[model samples]
Target: MKIRSDILRIYQSLHTWVGISAGLLLFIGFFAGALTMFKQPLDHWVSPPAPVPAMLREQEINSLAQQALAQHPAARKGFIMHLGEHENTVATMSWTAGKPGRELDFSGKQWMANLDQEGKLQAKEELPSILAQMIDMLHRTGGIPGKIGDEYLGGYLMGVAGILYFLALVSGLILLLPTLAKDFFALRPGKNRKRFWLDAHNIIGITSLPYHIVISITVIVFAFHDQFYDSLAEVVYKNQAMFGAPPPAAAKPYAAKDMLPLTSIISKVKAEAGDSRISEIQFFGLESPRPMARVALVNPRYLVQGPEAGYLIVHPYTGVIINASMLPGKESTWSAIVGPFFSLHFGSYGGDMMRWVYFAFGLSGAFLFYSGNLLWLEKRRKVQRPNQPLPVQTLSTRLMAAGTVGVCLGTVAGVCFTLVAGKLFAAAAENINFVYLFVYYSVFLSALAWSYLLGAARASVDLLWLCVLAALAIPCSSVIMALQSPSSNNLTGPGIELVAIAMALTFIYAARKTGKRIRDETKDSVWSLQQIQ
Candidate 1:
């Protein structure tokens, strides 16, 4: 009995310390992940971009391919084309201009190109939804340059945090076992501070355990994507390039002499990918006229569930299907499981409803972290002398608080600002994103600093109000901008506008509750200071 008790105590202590260590990073990751969940919707809201139907007919491809090729003859050696989807309209192509890695300095080396909907020339400036793309890049790579160095580091941090988060969650549940026998829904706010905090944490965490588990596992897999991919290759491919996954094959720069009939190839793709709508196509080794072609087809409905979802492969010659496999049978069992893990993390395996569920759970995860900080602070206050100077907060705690609340509130504000800015600025303007990021951080930092200096009771009230105000602004800004803009169709502009309205309403309610709490507590002097000091 004594040995088991000691082991349990050790686990509890380890779990608490581990959670404290990784809490902040996990908060940021979860918050960022939640934003990523709505990236498509936010993209649409920001730029009011149109979604193109997945219709890659032979004639369309032929016209676009010819135009693209004529514009970049160098692409013949190695190139790829991504026909845009319902959410995006610009077709993108990339190719190497010379030998792999080593090219004549004076020669045009390697580059990428973008084409508009009608096989017309388009510049990178033409894509207005780049703001959302930029956010995605930041979320994925933490906006690293040269190589994905910081990204990998952040991934490691998130991975360690995820493991700790899982352990903490399990231990937390075990600790709450004593209370679980009572009313699980009890939220006895009138109880002592520790009891109240424990109750709140346990109730929220326990109720959301399934979601937490899923997010934790998926986050670790996502953060350590290299591991997942390596596992996939080891287990599924067994050293064979089974999926026609890209090979390192490249050709020396050569003049384009013979051109394949792109029209014929497009026809073949449509015929072969019957019923499954073609979302995009890529032409590889484009520096040579006879480049390898590949196409991707998505059934829309199936993709949101698992690997039974979509088909993507390289066709060595436009006419042949090189490698084909559904999500379930396409790779080894390991790869198959890993595929679903990716989808779940990105919320790509489900429809709009599932995405919203992910968003909610993500927000809840963030809330868990925020509550954790407060709980820790409250715990420390109990042992500290009243009216004495408080100990300095650790750098991690300060940063965690700043990042947690600042980023969350800033994201809400930033999205709103992007929508208004998108219409005011020209479609190609990259400054819209710059403005949004700057504005969001400015507001976030100001609010966080104010909270820290003012202390918890005052800061909580103030910052909570700030969140309410920012969230409320989303709808108001959307409405005002939509009314002023010429392109403000109800379906396009007002569709997202409605979401903003709902968010605002929720915030208003939160603001009222928080404000009332502040007013009521201030009536008592002790409750105003030392209860939370």
Candidate 2:
């Protein structure tokens, strides 16, 4: 309690600089992360409107499985009994071919069955989630992996950022502790710019402090999970079971007489796993003596199969439950703890409502960093000479101004454009990812260049309007397609597009406000676009 003023001052400086350093990256992370909460839905929306094969009945599942195995021996190697099918879903009797990362190559393993004209079984792979995957990748990589030689390099940097953020949290809380009671609710938005920003930053940061802390810790875990596990094992377990699990049965192969039926395996899973929604039963290790099946279930109301939380492993041949995550009162203590962390980070614990809540919080979190950067620039405003050109200002602040406005707005446009592109290039599902990369990076880099060349104030204003156009283009494209063929447009995708446009319009409004600020308010600042000229 007897901390020195010098130490406190040092902490204050540390907090400011650390926050400013990671601000834009965190903004990108949070913004994209918010969208990722609804990644599945977005994946579905932008996915092909064409229907796949209908559901397989209980009797049909067994017959289909047998046929799949006979026709495609790779199905015996490892495949899934897909429990559900979507319009854009795919069905493969056998996973005969796949390259590294288990991305099925499908070059040799492709097969076709009786086409009932209505698709008795799924015909093709569901459209890949190009937009969602891109956003998710950017969030995880912090826009660094591609730039760096190694993909994990970006994650390593983000992990370091997490460390800095952890320090900022501690120092910030220390700074606010003495006045926590007084300014806990204090927000005076008078003429004082710092006061307004300080109030907002503190309010948002404090209220969501726990969430932020969770995010920081989880980001580190995600980026360096292997390291964390290795360190944890080395420090605590000493090669022992740090996290307990059901003992695996002998992996010896069994004959058909000894093996239990798939139905029996599923029944056991349902009984043990409770009211969980089964997703797919993944069969593996067919070449081995004892094949196994990962009975994957989607545990709604909790983070379940997405992170492999609640799963059951059955002997593939015998269908005997070798291991189950849902053993009654047998859940490992460490697993229980880790389960919620993944759930919280992925926002899969709750339903649609929770996703929306997370989305709002994520956008707010992005703003927290954006506002923090603005505050930094505002504080450094006095260090520059009056009416000095932006090029001559502190390189840090100038770069920050241009990079922030450019990258963030550019990402907005990139996403909107990619949505339209995903639809336009649905037929070329395999190559659509390349198009997404081209469009996204092109828009993103273009925005940064525009900002650096035209100046942040003007570029920011222009990009906001550009975002409006990009977003509106989605619905407009959908409408045009619908006019050409009414059945093609289902309105769900366009409805999302409309929402995006509505969101983009807010940027339009903000652009107007920013323009007013440059012309009417800012006089001696780099943001004073007219004055700078």
| Residue-pair clashes, model 2 | 6
lDDT of 2 by residue, 1-533 (tens): 34678888998899888987787778788888888887766766666565555666666666666655655554556666767443344552335344324121212233333234443443333224456767787787676644333345667788778877877787888878777878887889767867888889888889989988988888878877777889989998895866444445455654333445667777877887776777777777565575778776775555542442367777766556776544323445665667677777787766667877888889888888888788777777765664655424566667788888887888778778877887666565566667777788888889889998887777888998888889788877677656756776545544477677788778889888787877764555667765333
CA lDDT of every candidate: 0.57, 0.70
**lDDT per residue, candidate 1, 250-298, as tens digits?**
4553344344666655566666565666555666664443356556665
TM-score of each: 0.75, 0.86
Model 1 scores a C-alpha lDDT of 0.57
**Worst ten-residue run, lDDT, model 2?**
99-108
TM-score attained by model 1: 0.75
The residue-level lDDT of candidate 2 at 420 comes to 80
- Residue pairs clashing in model 2 are 98-105, 252-289, 253-289, 253-290, 259-318, 260-318
Regions of model 2 farther than 4 Å from truth: 1-5, 84-96, 100-129, 146-151, 185-191, 241-260, 303-309, 326-330, 383-392, 428-430, 493-495, 521-523, 530-533
Total clashes in model 1, counting residue pairs 3 or more apart in sequence or in different chains? 19
